[model samples]
Target chain A: MASFLEFRQVTVAFGDYVAVEGVSLALAPGAFVSLVGPTGCGKSTLLNVAAGLLAPSRGEVLLEGRPLKGLNPVAGYLFQQDAILPWKTALDNVALPLVFRGVPWGEARERARVWLEKVGLGRFLRHYPHQLSGGMRKRVGLAQVLIAGPKLLLMDEPFSALDIQTRQLMENELLRLWQEDRKTVLFVTHDLEEAIALSDRVVVMSAGPRSRPIGDFPIPLPRPRDVAEIRLTPEFLRLHREIWELLRGEVLRAHAGA
Target chain B: MRGLRVRLWQAGLLLGFLLLWEWASRTGRIDPFFFSLPSAIAQRVWRWFATGEVYPHLYITTVEMLLAFALGTLLGVVFGLWLALAPAVAAVLDPYVKALNAIPRVVLAPIFTLWFGLGVLSKVALGVTLVFFVAFFNTYQGVKEVSPLVLQNARLLGAKPSHLLRHVYLPAAASWIFSSLRTSIGFAVIGAVVGEYLGSAAGLGYLIAQAEGVFDTTGVFAGMVVLMAFVLALDALVGTVERRLLVWRSKEREGGSA
Candidate 1:
């Protein structure tokens, strides 16, 4: 099958500093792919390239066999920080993508209402981002991105700010949402366990000044895995050890450089 | 109950101050000729209202203030967004913006009167100058500080330039603009009154200046009191609008739990 999204020898640099160099990645349609790396590993830069927010200095990103010239036309990005409009209610924020697409106000709002309910925020339609808890805001963010119905979902450490318990719940929530339609996702994170638990294929990236993917591991874990309960399984532990062994050296190198 | 208590204390303080002033004037502790009795000022204000003598002056001042504020805010927001989004232009115009901002805007009142010829336009021009910087600086900062993550996410979700401006940029800058409303209104009042005080056919400032010319201290005191009341009313209106527009921020401060 043709890749839904492909990066061809992509490189990004900030003047004298090269953030990522010669990085090539691909995601098949409806696949769950996680890009994991140590701090400062250019995971976000790669994600930005895929989203077409930042054009690569060297190579290009191809979406469905065509080179993307500008912002990706069929992608939704969930940022690490709170990206929802602070002035808007949850309902308005969720309705925004539709609104931007020139959807009529009434119909867009009706659809947004459905999406908000799907994310379990039926009672929070009128609540502002500030009024919602960290986890609730994350749910709102999820609803916001998914409401747009993009083919490619790009998430950059979206739940890193949440506590451990909230993180697991959000992880499970993400999985549940992904299971419904299984849209192609390029999720970036530093958490090894999260990558193993939520992803079908985990791609590890090396530390920067010049960062690129160093290893790719395919997880043969069973479907419908619980993020919290999966940790105790023997197979899960073995995969964690194998990936962590390769990830630990790069993490130490990043720490020493910092 | 706490709000009511605070209001009662506020009213009590005002009443005590007025009573003391009236008593002191009556007892010959202070010369009523220069200081003016509180009762005399109150009576003057009452007669002006009853006979409708102050209506035209009040109308002129109100119109001028509103025009200046509306026009200034509009121009400020437009120019601010324009310059902030264009880094090359912003760098080129940096020194000039600082220089213009540094000049005492009050000095421009005389020039404005001379150029616009002491009508409502002169006051409005002066007011615009005063209010413009307050709105401009706040708006400039607001646009410049919009979250990069939000912009990126919006683009990935298929927001065009116009869509981003309407949905993201305007809403982001609105908080900053609303915050500066009170300050800009105050500047508007200053510009209108000062322009009229210098030279104008009608306005609250003209009334005060006319009274001072003839040494009618009571009329001057009455004018001052009316002006104070007018400003307070305008401020209260601004407070209402701000609360309505920035409900998200206020809720954030309240820390409403999800």
Candidate 2:
């Protein structure tokens, strides 16, 4: 079977400083993979390479078995920071991708309205990014990405800024959304619990200045798991301990270097 | 009702100031020759309106200001975005832009009047000079300061270069440009008025210059008052447009950006 996405021996460097080195990763069709790493582990750099925002110093990133050049058009990216246009209302922000593609304003707006409703922001369509809570802004960001219906989704520490409850709610919402269409998602996070809760496969990365995958664990948890409830299960606890053992060394190394 | 109360308070404050000024002038406590009584200035303004003498000059001044503002802002945004995006151009032009900005722009009024021959064109040319740098620098910063994450996200959502400009760059730059609006528009009015003062036969500035020549302090004061009101109205207009365009700025409830 053909892989949906592949990063072949990728390395990213800025001048003499290497951020990531000799890292390779691949995703199967409709797979959800979480990349777990310590602080400054260059997870974002890897994601950028996949998104085609940054070019690899070595090797190549392939999307759907083709060499991806410039930006990968088959994907949507959700950033850790609020990336919604502050000057545009929630509806307009969600409608932006379609508008950029030369869709008529009225039709795009209608579609954006529907997406906002799906994200539970229908009542606040006219509100700006500033007027929304952090959680609300995250919902807008989610709707903005999903509105385009991309083949792949790249999320970099997307829920790290949220409180635990909001984070779990967003994670559950994400899982529900993912289950419906099954788009390939590559999620980056420092949270082991989040990784275990949300992903089919959790790939553990070592700390920088030469970050690489140290372990890849396929989750055996049943389908449609609630992000909050799954944490209490013995199976989830066992997996957490196994992953944390590998991750703890890297986290300590990152802290000592910092 | 709250808005109305605020307006009423503002009106009362203005009336009180006028009354105090009138009293001081009538009692010969202050020299009315230079300061000019508020009543006299008001009477002069009222007479000009009643006799329909202010219309032609107001029309000419408005035309010059509007033309200069539109032309300067358009060129400013285009060139600013270009320079910011193309690093080579920016590197080459950095010192030159600084040098031009350093030159006291008011001195250019006589030169513009000389080149464009003391007409509306000359006034507009002078106005453009004052407005261009302000709009340019703000727009440059606006485009330069766009979050890398936002740009990457926009690209991953399938934005072309042109699409990026329309959807990402322009909207990002717009808030900065709008912030510069009141200042740049003030410069436009100043340019028109100054150009008229230096050489033109018409406009509010010309009226003040003519009054100063004949030693009619009331006419000069009336012209100044009119100019003040004119700018206030224009600034308010810009505020209205900004509110309409920047609707997304109002919703920042909390800091949860995912």
Q: Which candidate is the best by TM-score?
A: 1
Write the residue-wise lDDT of candidate 1 on A146-201 in tens digits. 99898889999999999999999999999999999999999999999999999999
How far is B43's C-alpha from truth in model 2 (Å)? 2.0
lDDT of 2 by residue, A1-258 (tens): 789999999999999999999999999999999999998999999988988888999989989899989878888889999888776788988998888778998999999999999878899998877778999999999999999888899999998899988989999999999999999999999999999999999999999998999999999999898999999999999999999999999999999999
Query: Interface RMSD computed for candidate 2 is what?
Result: 3.3
* Span of ten consecutive residues with least summed lDDT in model 2 chain B: B249-258
Residue B36 of model 1 has an lDDT of: 94
lDDT per residue for candidate 2 within B77-157, as digits (tens), equals: 888999999999999999999999898978987778678898999999988988999899989998888877677677766
Query: Worst 10-residue stretch by lDDT in candidate 1 chain B?
Result: B249-258
Among all windows of ten consecutive residues in candidate 1 chain A, which has the lowest summed lDDT? Answer: A79-88
Global lDDT of each candidate: 0.90, 0.89
